[model samples]
Target: MSVEVNNETDYEVDLHDVQKLADSITEAMFIHPETEVSIVFIDEDAMSELHVEWMDLEGPTDVMSFPMDELRPGSETAPSESGILGDIVICPTIAEAQAKAGGHAVHDEILLLTTHGMLHLMGFDHEEPEEKAEMFTLQRRLLEGYTGRPAPKETVE
Candidate 1:
């Protein structure tokens, strides 16, 4: 899978690790190897602007997904079509505060959000209770499977 991670923020994150997690998820979910997905790390200001522009919200959210092709999950025999899976934009500043409150590493929280955003890209919604359960259950499963392996570490630049 062509998972491109672009760190536009000053936060010290392991770009490769995030990309690997995304790649693993897409591969496991049967997304085509030619499909393109971008994970972008941005500052709070940029995120907030996007939040307002796209979602018409007030403040910066942890993550936001902008899907392009509306791709759905496919089976092993028939993978999803190759196309732009869209962008998952995350704000590290917001993530850090959430991690502190959740008592987990920032990277782990980011991974959770990444998976959450991925689910959204795959047309999973949580506006309703049933949708919430299904999406969250899958999210938890994906995160659990990924955490079993050693996730990438943050590097100080």
Candidate 2:
């Protein structure tokens, strides 16, 4: 898998750890080894602009995903086809605030957002009750599997 990380914000984040997490997620999801994904960390202002432009939302959000070649998770016996997975844009400023409110480390929240974005890239969504449950459950499982720690509980929106 080709997981590229670009930090365009002034906030300090461990790019290598983000890359590792992305790699781990792709591997666990049985995505093709040649699949490509980009994770970009941007400032709050840029995030807000994207939020309004892409989602029609008002403020900066934790993360947003722009899938290139739509792909889905595959079984180990039949991995997903090689393609461009998507782009994940994260706002560390917003993530830090959410982390403080949730009583978790900022890095952990960032990782959780990364997992959420990755799931979205793989055609997962949380619009309905059942969809939300399934997506959040999978998100928590993936994070716990990668970190070997209990994932923070996600609240219903």
Candidate 3:
């Protein structure tokens, strides 16, 4: 498996941690060695345009995923052999905003969005309650592994 991370933000993120998380996210999805994924950190303006074009949302969102099923990372694959998982674009500015809203650290929020994007590439969605539960559960599990920390405490209201 191959992973690429490109940062376009002013805030400094832990490159090693992000790289490990990207690898873990790909492994969590059971990707083969032929799989490739990219993580790009962007500013609010660039992120907002992507959100508008892809999901038709009104403004910048935390993360956006672009799946390229035919391009694996690192090695050039024969057109038929590549399993391009996709690209993940994250906005640290938005993540910081959400960290405050969600009562979590900015790093934690960024981790959440990274895993969320990976899940989307793995055919997971949160359009329904049940789907949301399963996806979120998997996301949490993957995150736990990525961070070497306990899973977040889940509460039912």
Best by TM-score: 2
- Sorting all predicted structures by lDDT, with the top scorer first, yields 2, 1, 3
Rank the models by TM-score, top first. 2, 1, 3
How well does each candidate superpose onto the true structure, as a TM-score?
0.93, 0.97, 0.84
Runs of candidate 3 exceeding 4 Å displacement:
70-82, 151-157
lDDT of 3 at 18: 79
Q: Give Cα-based local distance difference scores for all models.
A: 0.86, 0.92, 0.75
Candidate 2, 54: how far from true, in Å?
0.7
The TM-score of predicted model 2 comes to 0.97
What residue runs in model 2 are displaced by over 4 Å at the alpha carbon? Answer: 155-157
Please state the error at residue 21 of candidate 3 in Å. 0.9
- Candidate that scores best on lDDT: 2
Can you give the lDDT of residue 32 in candidate 3? 71
Error of 3 at 73 (Å): 16
- Distance from true location, Cα of 40 in model 2, Å: 0.3
Kindly list the per-residue Cα lDDT of model 1 for residues 1-157, writing each as its tens digit. 8889999988998888889889988988999999999999999999989999998998999999999999998899999999999999989888888888777789887898898899899999888889888988788788779889543321210
| Collision pairs in model 2 | none
Model 1 Cα shift for residue 120 (angstroms): 0.7
RMSD of each: 4.7, 1.1, 5.1
